[model samples]
Target: MAVINNDSSVFQRIPNELANSIFDFLPNRDIKNLRLICRYLDRHVPLRFNRVFISANPLDVKVFLAIANHDTFRKQVKELIWDATLQSPRSCGNDSDDDYGSDEDSSDDNDYQGQSRFQRGCREAIEDAESRLVDKADGNEQQSLLDNLMTSGRALSYYERLVEEQADVLETRADEEAV
Candidate 1:
């Protein structure tokens, strides 16, 4: 027999086994919020985001390092996996016939449609940035505009460097060293 009190914490009202099981189903974000919400939940709920992945994307390694360095999560981490999937533009496409998919058309309408979100966003960002700069400059030299474009990822050369840095981090086992 169990006693239920209206004023008690939801966890306190439930059986310990049930409460523990609920933690397993909670989403990572919810778990984080729960931990921050109360010390009781923090001590009771085991770390569920135990597996961390590092990929060519800089964000992946950054997140992995953040979790690996976490005081509580560091002790509970079970696995560190490397995601070898390279971040290439248009990574997916309609491959009904397969055969390496379609090549660029002269019109480029289909090509634009086939581009990944990352590709489109990067292009749009550069265009938007250039437009804004031009508006502010009131006809500054074109060379300065070109330099701004160059620094703004320079057609993804900056992204390539980030990928190279990620590889270096993995090769150096920086994530492992963080714990």
Candidate 2:
């Protein structure tokens, strides 16, 4: 026999606003699932889902050019952050000796030049990306760029977390060393 209650409503009933709020914080994969639930619910999410992230990948010029040419998803991108792992060869500024640091002032000039060159290269890259934005390029190019962007972005965030952890570890080690 089937059991029936006259005062029954819904077992899993949640307020729409509350549900949307909860769903917003869910992972991207879960969000995809949530979107499949209903079109009304999917409309609540922002457009950021369409844009991709590529943070730390060592990208070649061609790969960079490709991402700038994507069609449907490209227009949704508000900003693109390229974290090229370009660093100066000299860490002499971090040296403890003041006199030695002062003596190596010329090295600072070299570092400045290196930095300017790097900045120029980045500017050129941005220009190139912008130029490719309107072209009817190969769809594969955009996909490759999207992959690189996601991979790089993930790697950068991972490294940032690792650096924070390392800092904490160093502090603990220093305390132990001092003791």
Candidate 3:
């Protein structure tokens, strides 16, 4: 025997407007998670993520291409913005130490001229901290500060690689090709 239902399921019964309103209030992450949880919700709440960002980063361009190529996501893209700013050739200020830091040593130029402004600042700060440590810190505090500064320096190096990659991308007009 076949059973006939007079009433439809709650999801099929819900209005699109109400679903849109609910989705509008939810964050992007939440919307994605919600869709994954319930197929009914996924089908009912069509993604309204209309805006996207593109930058010098390779992953950024790759993702943009993926979206543009996609049948559904392509329709949602409303804007394609280019991030022009690139972190190229860090300036080691030779003009005045006052601009970089007030430390007395900064006033006297030396081999440290090769260091970036931020690197100089970190070095000055660490030196100042070491002096304050007095007898309490022999090499222990200095080593800790050195470790932290080294980590920061490593991060800066990674960023520099990205900057170089961005410059290459623009030179080859890879962005135009992707489009």
Instruction: Tell me, by TM-score, which candidate is best.
Output: 3
Model 1 weakest lDDT span, ten residues long: 102-111
Per-candidate TM-score against the hidden true structure:
0.40, 0.23, 0.55
Candidate lDDT scores, in order, read: 0.61, 0.44, 0.66
lDDT of 2: 0.44
lDDT of 2 by residue, 65-142 (tens): 455575644566666554434323324353343222232244311122223323334334544764666564566575
Cα RMSD, model 2: 19.0
Q: In candidate 1, how many Å is residue 122 off?
A: 1.6
What shift in Å separates residue 12 of candidate 2 from its native position after superposition? 12
Stretches > 4 Å off in candidate 1: 1-8, 56-80, 86-121, 125-164, 170-179
Which candidate do you rate higher for TM-score, 2 or 3?
3
Residue 155 in model 3: shift from native, Å? 1.2
Give one digit per residue, the lDDT tens place, for model 3 in 25-64. 9887887776666667676666654777677667778988
Which regions of candidate 3 deviate over 4 angstroms?
1-21, 24-29, 36-46, 91-115, 120-150
Q: How do the residues 21-125 of candidate 1 rate in per-residue lDDT, one tens digit apiece?
A: 887788888887877766667667766667878765556767877786778877777887877765443335552333323324324221233434444565566
Quote model 2's TM-score.
0.23
